[model samples]
Target: MPPADIDIERATTDDLEAVADAWVRLARNQANHGSHVLADPNRETMLATLGAYQVDGGLLVARDRETVVGFASVTVERGSLALDCTRGLLSNLYVEPEYRGRGIGTALLEAAEDELRGRGVDICTLEAMAENESARRFYRQAGYDSFRIGFERTL
Candidate 1:
């Protein structure tokens, strides 16, 4: 599909279910790449959060003619101690596997950034599972550098 075919816009109450479904798929897929999140078990929590996103205007959905094929969640966060400016968090960005390479993900990402920038956010942060090299590469190519690294050791 052409990039023009996809519409990126803020999610609505009507889009909550579709957005939640995409988020579940994203979390489940991340498990294969070192994520510890229990996607299925968190469905209720995720759904609740989507409701909040809707009201906050922080959730975006990418639709290919009324079917949501991708979505991104962006939120503003207050800095913790020592920091002066607020930050934008790109908490979620996912494009369906079949929609890969169609530029939908890039469109979603750019829209998310623009949403943040419009809110006066100058810096943004996102996370990609360390084992998900493809996601890491995609973010890198989009001009995001490694600002922090997390290390974990399971007991």
Candidate 2:
């Protein structure tokens, strides 16, 4: 649970497989926080997508010794509005259940934000499951606030 227990670093191409696997787990976790059936991502497609953005942004990983315990996908994206504002999307941030209480998540998040800032992003946005109170609390503590509400229904 201590901040010094892990090291945060930018993931390299060699970490492709691990990043993909972690992404799958993060999708499952989000689904668990809400009522929904989340489909598995196509590994090949996901890998290419994550890999493609390496030049602009990247996957930041939290490592315990040589083992990766958590990761976050940071990317630059255009804001929804027509205005020309640079937006950084915190696409995914995941910490294994066993390491949830540690400072790993916070470290990865801060690192991702710092990376975005370095890239000239004017603002960064992240979303949490509407019903995941703890996640909401965590994001709030991480300097995020709610500005939009999304509605969805199973078809």
Candidate 3:
């Protein structure tokens, strides 16, 4: 599908529930790699996180008409040891499975870059699980280069 038909906009407070639902879906897809998964988030926590994103002002969503096809979150933060501190983090990016490969992800990433650049963010960064080769390729094609190795050991 052509991306021109899709409408992309910043998410509002009213979108909190939808955003939370999307987050949960994406999280479930993540590897269990020794992290606790909460089945439900209380209203207060959900509202607080979504509210914080709204205040930070960088959540963007792509909608095919009224249905949100994909969403991404961008934020400027002090980068960790490997990432550049001057860059904006592409914190979260996900598309509904049905919407994959239709340019929704591309549009979302472009939107994120626009928002980050508007804020004087000269660089952008994101991380994907090493096991997710598709995600790594997607990021690489989107102009991200791998610069650091991530390591973890269970104690």
Candidate 4:
């Protein structure tokens, strides 16, 4: 599908369920790339999170005509008082599997950034699984670089 066909707009209360569904799919995909999340078990939590995002006007949906094809959720992250900049966190981004590579994800991401910028956010941050090379590459192409890296261990 052409990029022009996808419409990126703020998500409404009516979109919460669809956004949660997309989030679940995103979690399932991440699980294959080293994420430990349990998607199905977290449906209610995801719904609540989506509601919060909606309340903050940080939930965006990408629609191809009347059908929602993807969503991006963002939030302002204020660190300790010692931090230099308030960051806009791209908390979640996902496009339907069939919509991948059609520029929908990029549209959603850019829309998210614009939403943040409108709120006076000059910096942004997001996390992708270490093993998800495709996601890393996409972020790099979008002009993002890693300023922090995390390591985890299981006892």
- Which candidate number maximizes TM-score? 1
Q: What C-alpha lDDT do the candidate models reach, one value each? A: 0.90, 0.80, 0.78, 0.90
Off by over 4 Å in 1: 79-82
Clashes per candidate, residues 3 or more apart or on different chains: 0, 0, 0, 0
Task: Point out the higher-scoring one by lDDT: 3 or 4.
Answer: 4
> Which is superior by TM-score, 1 or 3?
1
- Which pairs of residues have clashing backbones in candidate 4? none
Ranking by lDDT: 1, 4, 2, 3
- In the range 1-155, model 3's lDDT, one tens digit per residue, is 23877888899877767877887777667644333445365445655666687678888888888777778888887645665446888878989998898888888899889999999888887878777788889998888899888887879
Writing each residue's lDDT as its tens digit, candidate 2 over 1-155 gives 32786888888787777887877777777777883645374666777877865545577888888887888888878656775678889987889889988787888888998899998898898888898898889999987989999998778
TM-score of every model? 0.95, 0.86, 0.85, 0.95
Runs with alpha carbons beyond 4 Å of true place in candidate 3 = 32-47, 78-85
Where does candidate 2 stray beyond 4 Å? Answer: 35-41, 79-81
| Angstrom error at residue 6, model 3 | 1.4
lDDT of 4 at 115: 92
Better of 2 and 3 by TM-score: 2
- TM-score ranking, best first: 1, 4, 2, 3
